[model samples]
Target chain A: MKPLHISAYTTVSALGRGNAAMLEALRAGKSGLQPLHFPPAELKTYVGFVEGLEHEPLPEELAAFECRNNRLARLALRQDDFEQQVAALRERHGASRVAVLIGTSTSGILNTELAFRRRNEAGELPVEFDFVHSHQLSSLVDFVRRLLQLQGPGFTVSTACSSSAKVFADAWRLMAAGLCDAAVVGGVDSLCLTTLYGFNSLELVSAEPCRPADSQRNGISIGEAAGFAILEREPVEGSRGQLLGFGESSDAYHMSTPHPDGLGAVEAMQAALARAGLASSDIDYINLHGTATPSNDRSEDRAITTVFGTNTPCSSTKGWTGHTLGAAGITEAIIAMQCIEHGLMPASLNTRQLDPDFGSTILLEQRETTVNRVLSNSFGFGGSNCSLIFGGRNDHPLP
Target chain B: MTTLYLDNLGVVAPGLSDWPGAAKVLRGEADHLAEPLKLTAPELLPATERRRSSDSTRLALRAAEQALSLEAAQRLQPAAVFSSAYGDPTITHKLCELLSGTPPMASPTLFHNSVHNAPAGYWSIATANPMTTTSIAAGDESFATGLLYAAAQVVAEQRPVLLISYDLPYPKPLSEKCEVSAPFASALLLSHQASAQSIAQLSLSLDKGPETIMDLPLESLRRGNPAARALPLLAILASASGECLLPYLAEQRLHITVTPCR
Candidate 1:
């Protein structure tokens, strides 16, 4: 796979808006997780919920597309000048030549969840309910495309946690196939009753703030986030980093649980390495999928040890932002790029002690290093797995 | 332009059970019937998992099983692209109601099966094929978008791909908003290399023209279900050869040129 330039990117999560807030939180090791206070469905678990979405609706002209998920997407677009960057891209490649590929597990089902509460006697939902623009999985891509006024091919990938990560791969292929000269790839997922109670039902929601790879770790802290990135065939004037390679695979062993041995994770990582033409030693850091769940951390540990071994430093930023689900891929991918630029590799925030049984080198404290190349892992429900490799343009030569 | 071979086909809709049987209806040899959708667990899944499968998963797997014949199913393990406009409407309705209940306790089985890629996950487990799989959506154009993604994979990876597109109507309150009233699913085994058994060759290009609409009894089916939007293309395959346009993104259409190989 040929390298594509990540010319611009931005994200909004519990850590706050844009790359600056994320960098500040990581540098200070400040976690954005807070006690669960979302109204309606009550759960004891903490969440990385972004405040003020309900108060701030979308602009009036785009009223039909109003939803919490789209609100977050527009918020992220406003930050880091991502909207302007997309506009410049459209000018360079034409509106019809730019594709939108956004990922989301649940686009805006909160509207439907709320509508169900207000159903009338005849079981008819409120007349104002708009399922197509609000709750549909493709609404994310459609909203983003309309916001940016791009007329190219657009779609939404909904493969749970691997959704956003896979969008980068999709963008690369579309560009390689000459379908689009530049592409917009990202993910947006908002906190909803379905996810809160859903994860609780599966026994995967941690009551306290998540501690990835910790000895006393319990489960995940759900988070809502929106992130976007511009992928161009070549580096533009202010290119940030380049997408080196990506690998995707399935566990095929279980739907919610990962493989005990992490064999599928190993396949995805190995494939990414092969595609990037890089050895395990070449990666300076790894952004572990580390949802903080016992099975996930254990399985990912085995996979990491099988490939990169215990020498390479790695940590899960999920401790700070919680598991953003679908947005995790792009969020972590952007963090991997930050590690390349800022030289600050974060520790597993909120984690007290590393799991003694794990063999891999799980970092518990922050370290400043000359990070060149980094690999980020995102594994979703249904055993979908993706691994992405990112690097600084100058230091790591293209394969 | 990239081209892919349609090695095999699968169909599961109101009157369409399988490709061969449905071809008769498409070729005008038989009338299009209005029978309820028939769904059963894909035997590929274990008994326990099969019991836990939802209608969406069953519909998708049923078509996938038909498309991947016993020979190909054993000899070639193709990566899959599962697309649906509204994935598993029944599951979504059930989960919504479950969440709206007092104290709101969700069902673990339903939550896991609610992901858009649930069928893809079940397929991976059923076939034990750990290749890459993706679940995508483009609303009403989900089938065309999935085809584009599958075709891109075939050309870029040079590997066979199984594209399964399915959608089930929502119940009651939700149904009033998005009026998808029927269940439809179809699977196409696409590859870059053509074989002796290849049924048709597909070449896709983007356009802004109108889409090919279905006629007579199939028109309602095509409009009612997102997956059934492939009726025109399927009709072309049933006949000898032709070109048809399917809706893509806003104002864009996927102009597909079909060349019969068999």
Candidate 2:
């Protein structure tokens, strides 16, 4: 796996808009999970919702692409100077040399949900409803690609939670194939009634702030976010993170539940370590795909022990940001990159007591330690799994 | 740009059942009629899993079965890229209607089956293959985008790839708006290893021009079904001469020139 420079990156999670907001939240041990206050007030679960998006208006020219998901994409692109960063990238790489690959589970199904509710007496969608641009899954990638004015290859990877994480792998392969010089790889998934009640119907929604790796952990708290990163062949002067390698695999076990023993999880982690030319012991910390579900934590714990032997510290940041679903890959990837840049180990947020049955060591405090390399794990439904390793520079300020 | 060898092909669309059937239409010896595909479930999957699979999943598995034999599929365990314009509109509509009800709770099975990668997951489980699989979407350009991505992987990794593009019509409200007329699925077994089974070698490069559309008979097919985006390339593979162009990404199309090996 060749190393690609992470020239620019930003995240718009409940923690707030960019890397600074995320870094501050992690260092200050802040939790972004809030009580279920949005519509479907009956859903009795918490979520990491991006605030004030309903008020943010899309530009007139892009009004045809209006939707909660696209609005989140527009807002997230504005933060961390993400738009400006891509503009400079287009200049350096040539607009035709750069590609756009984004991941999203449900692009704008919320808009369709609204259209369905507003169906006319004839059962037709509203007059202004533009199904092609708004409800299409590829619309997310198209929206971002048009915004960046990129002319190279582009597509949307939608393998559930691992969707965005797999984009890093796609960018790497395409660049290796000499197809694209640079790529804007990220994801955005805004909150909607579908996700809110969907998980609840599955009986996987945690009413209170979720606790990962806790014996009493019941289920997950849904979160919505948008995150993006620029990956190029050469490192720029201000580049802070380098993607060393990524490993992807399917569980082949179940559709909804993970492999009870986390076989696919172990394979993804080992593959990432092997590609990075590093052993498990060299990984300073692991960002677990801990969704605070009893089954997921136990299964992943087994896999972690099978590979790393429980010496390295690990935590599930979902306790802080909830589970951002499709946007989680980029959200956690940025957090891992920030962990590499700043020697701050974020605490596994809401865990009061760790389950003693788990074999991996779970960190519960923000440790100011020497962090060199970090492995981030994102496993999705139907057994889709991706593990990304980010590290290059050894220089980091101790918190 | 690298050249990819198309080892074998499988297609299921209205009137055109297989590559041989499609070749007739491509040659104008026969006409492509607008009709529904009569598909049978792939026996490769376990009976229980097969019963639970969705129409889109069945469409992909049927194409996959035709492209590769049982022994070959098991022996190669090829990594797959399942591309679809719409995941499972039936399941999506069902879930939507369920969620809109009075304090709705979605059926967990329907929710899982609605994922874009549901087909890919089913393929992996049915074949018992552990290799990495990806499912992507790119609207009307899904077929071309998927082929380009698979070709790059096959070239860069030098391994055979199973590329499957499948889509189906939505139920009520979405059906009227969406252009998908009928169910369609196509599969291409691509490899860098040239062998006797190889039909043609395709090389593609970025062309800054308008997208190439097929002629009259196939034009409507291409316009109507998103999965029919492969018609141009498939027709070229079935023909001895002439080239085809496919939409790669925004403002750029891939000019593909096919060289027959036979």
Top-scoring candidate (lDDT):
1
Deviating ranges (above 4 Å) for candidate 2: A394-399, B208-211
- Per-residue lDDT of model 2, residues A158-232, tens digit only: 998899999999998898888889999999888877777777767888989999999889999999899999999
Give the residue spans of candidate 1 off by over 4 A: none
Residue-wise C-alpha lDDT for candidate 2, range B1-262, written one tens digit per residue: 7788888889888788777888888888887886767656777677888878888888888888889876887788787899998888888888877766666557878888888888888887887777789999999889888988898888877889999998888998888778687777899999987899888888877676766788886787787778888888877777765677777666567788899877
Q: Write the per-residue lDDT of candidate 1 for residues A13-43, one digit (tens) a residue.
A: 9999899999999999989999999878688
> Native-contact fraction for each model?
0.86, 0.68
lDDT of 1 by residue, B157-201 (tens): 888999999999888778888889689999999988889878889
What lDDT would each prediction earn against the true structure?
Answer: 0.90, 0.85
Best by DockQ: 1
Question: Residue pairs in steric clash, candidate 1?
Answer: none
Who wins the TM-score comparison? 1
DockQ of every candidate: 0.85, 0.71
Clashes per model (N, Cα, C within 3 A)? 0, 0
